[model samples]
Target: MKASRWARAAALLVLVGFTASCGLPRVGPNKREIYSGSVQREGDAFIVSVNDRVTRATAVVPALGFSAAFRNAGIVGSDTIRPGDTLGLTIYENVDDGLLAGQGLNATMLEEVQVDGAGFIFVPYAGRIRAAGNTPEAIRRLITERLADQTPDPQVMVRRVAGDGATVTVTGAVTQQGVFAIERPTRTLSAMLARAGGVAVEPETARVKVIRNGHTGEVWFEELFEDPQADIALRGGDRVLVEADTRSFTALGATGNQTRVRFETQTISAIEAIAQVGGLSPTTGDPTGVFIFRNEPEEIAKQVLGRTDLIGAQRLVYVLDLTEPNGLFLARDFVIRDGDTVYVTEAPFAQWSKALSAVSGTLGLASSLASIADNLNNN
Candidate 1:
């Protein structure tokens, strides 16, 4: 009788597996092209509207394509220059007066200068000079020429009042929001960010925005940070912005990919979310029980009814029956909303597997107890 019982249980397990086969095809969700032409258009509009090219590119472009755009536009994602940058100057021929006082040409005293937004520095004698873009060596030459025409053996010294000129401002998701003074003369956007602080979060999907003369442009954080040769270089009036990581969701259990996913609200679809998580774990998943649990259930129903109200309550807790083969296409067309949790149910076979495992575990424990009791009796 015991043998017969075991046989029957084994047959039941097999039947469970067989019946599940008819429900829905078990496979990883199809790879989705999350970023499409429409997304590109919308992102472009955002960039234009913000008047900041950096904002549009980071938030709008397909994550992959954004990198290319950033490279082309010369936006740096991670570099920053802040207050307290160091500037040094050496004076030739005029060291006799002991250096001009306060970045001046006065004999005997030279003083460190302060820079302003217009890139100009006020000197004791020469007044304000545009010093933002000029290289150190170049500035030195200019001083030499200016002094030669004034006093005999006029020695002039040039140095950064502070190293602020080589730096830039980086806000958003960087380690810190501040100015990062560039160390080397040939400072790229990437280098500036490293100096200020690296990114504060994951680089993937992180948006990199740059503001130039109030015009905003965007790119991927990685492209601007990791790829220096191609993506990040600073131009005058360039500002690098890195946005913080946005909240996303995960699709598991019966879904195509059993992986965690990140997406903007209303940007992903039920189908696309499934494919991103590496599909459901086959041994423990049910393909047909694909459901999305949203806080706004009504929002989902509105979509089914083709109503203009894209978000409602019922839509939040709606379920998708992928048992029908054609549902695959429909899933692709559906847009996923933020905070929507996708769940795939367990098939009968999976349930049976769980039951059998539980039974086996229980029996093993019992047997171990029996053996211990028998040994005690013998003793």
Candidate 2:
């Protein structure tokens, strides 16, 4: 009985040490710069920002009245076609009844046309067709005239065999990967993604960028998701890349989960931010260390705390304490801006438990190994 009790006690001691190691307080040492501030809490909820700064303008305006920004931003132009672009065409005078023979298009090589990388498609009987700068109607008329000499009543139908031009590239978190061909006008970015088997990972933020004519343009993905007017249409030969969320906000220090969240809008609330992080850990989290680091000094915390000494009127640190129950109400109302960080500190006991647990695990593991070795030797 005594030996069994001793063995059990030893095992418990080892486990206690292991538990302590896992309990250590985590204070991330790196001081990352961020933009954080307090926003007044109101019962009403509203959208953060309506205007997008990066996507609103383009670089140049063509004679066609399309803005320069539209071109620089990759929003317009035939050379700027992306995957899932639709090209429509109506043939003019040359209708080919002989080739059809009351059935369909003849199996002759003359019916085949090759689309090139430069946004040009070649019709066998028509020779080199200039499609880069021309609209679908223009391409059809050009084809109709070229075949007028050889075949009477030559009717030409023009549409994209795949994409507006030739190929489209998908970058970032997609599954099947790389640039691919668009074979039909009914294809879409969403459809292509579905064909590609969808995105590899579901990020906190989701967005798609359209690159064309060597320019980067952003699609209003949220608008596209909501079927709004702000959503831009895609073109052939355009590269569509769906990447992980570009913006992220980090929550460090004392929280249930120290994780980063994607930023969708310009403004977020402290309560919302806390909710994203899974809230406070019951045993270790301290209400006092809840802070939003900014360019300002510690004195910033004083205003939030309604106290004057701790923040010291310095211009470097901004801290906020949620010790008071009313602080929760204030925090719920406070607005957290983009690129903000929310941190909470662990209690002293929690920190000590973590440190002791670490030391205990190392010692316990060593002791367990030593006991096993002794038993083996005895056997």
Candidate 3:
């Protein structure tokens, strides 16, 4: 009886392994395009381990593409004069002995001078002086010097007419839309938005695009406040647009949640992002196989794949091995870019557990069948 029982138990174990073949390591959930490909640009994506070389050379993404725009912040809102400017000139001379006093005219006179197309402003005796690229104080000194020969100790003053020139074009998603002049010292992006009565709609989806000259820079509206770098200086003729942020990403597989999530902030790290989607399912999630699929830019993708022949594949799969302690750290630092797909692989033990369950059922069934046979033989 003992030998027979042992044989039966051994048979059940074999049946369990055979029936559970489907639950193997390379099962359906684990064999997605993200796991199969080696290079990113190969239609499907392959995992690129986050190492020092890759991390240093190929930056973990969510690249805001704001570098070019942030760099231009230094150039906007210069006090230097430009064409289409209006200046307020006040000439004061001592009634006893100054240049105006010598002219036998009024001791003080106020004149509003409009800058011409050539960026030159005309004075009574100064002819045409170049006002462009010069500040008001510089222009005032220049005028004083020019009138020095005309009269004894001439006192001249120059000022920019308020609400006159250097205006920023505020359009798109503004409660108050108008052409507002950029006050001296150059106004910031937030100042302009406030002037427009703030955003009309919920700020959750708003994005601010600053287009200056031929270079255009776009950033999420919230970011403009959180990071000063994003609030670039507004220049004359610069177009500022506040529109909805349309970037989103899809989450699938064993994650706690599977849906399209919009970018709520300017940037998000992988760890917090996973939490936002309910994180990996404890019951079925594979701690070793957290992955992110993204169709990234060619330049950014190259940093990870290190392949020059990236002809067909713009798709990439980034993985985090949650089983390793280091993975948690990497996840904290890893950035999740817009349009990325977050997925967690099914647990490796899920198949084993199912197969063992089947075996246990088979064992109980075999035991009952054997008892019935013994009863029949005795009868």
Output the number of the TM-score-best candidate.
Answer: 3
Report the error of model 2 at residue 364, Å: 20
TM-score of each: 0.47, 0.47, 0.58
Error of 2 at 334 (Å): 3.8
lDDT tens per residue, model 2, 1-379: 9999999888866776666556444665322212222132322211121112211211111111123453333334433333333444434333435432333543232232444556566565577777665655677778778877867766666664444345566777778776555544324556566556667755334566767678665543343445433344445566777775555668987787888887654346666787788887788777655665433224443443344566333222234456765666656656564456777766657656765667667788999999999999999
Q: Would you list the C-alpha lDDT of every candidate in the order shown?
A: 0.54, 0.54, 0.72
- Candidate 2: what lDDT? 0.54
Summarize candidate 1's per-residue lDDT along 163-279 as a digit string, tens digits.
Answer: 444456778778878765544543566666676577876766577677766656665666664555445566544678887546577675654455557773325666667777766
Worst 10 residues of 3 by lDDT: 56-65
Off by over 4 Å in 2: 1-68, 71-106, 109-158, 163-170, 174-204, 212-215, 225-229, 234-238, 258-268, 295-316, 323-325, 335-341, 347-379
Worst 10 residues of 1 by lDDT: 43-52
Off by over 4 Å in 3: 3-28, 31-44, 60-188, 200-206, 212-215, 220-238, 306-314, 355-379
RMSD of each: 12.4, 13.1, 10.1
lDDT at position 224, candidate 2: 48
Error of 1 at 97 (Å): 8.1
Candidate whose lDDT is highest: 3
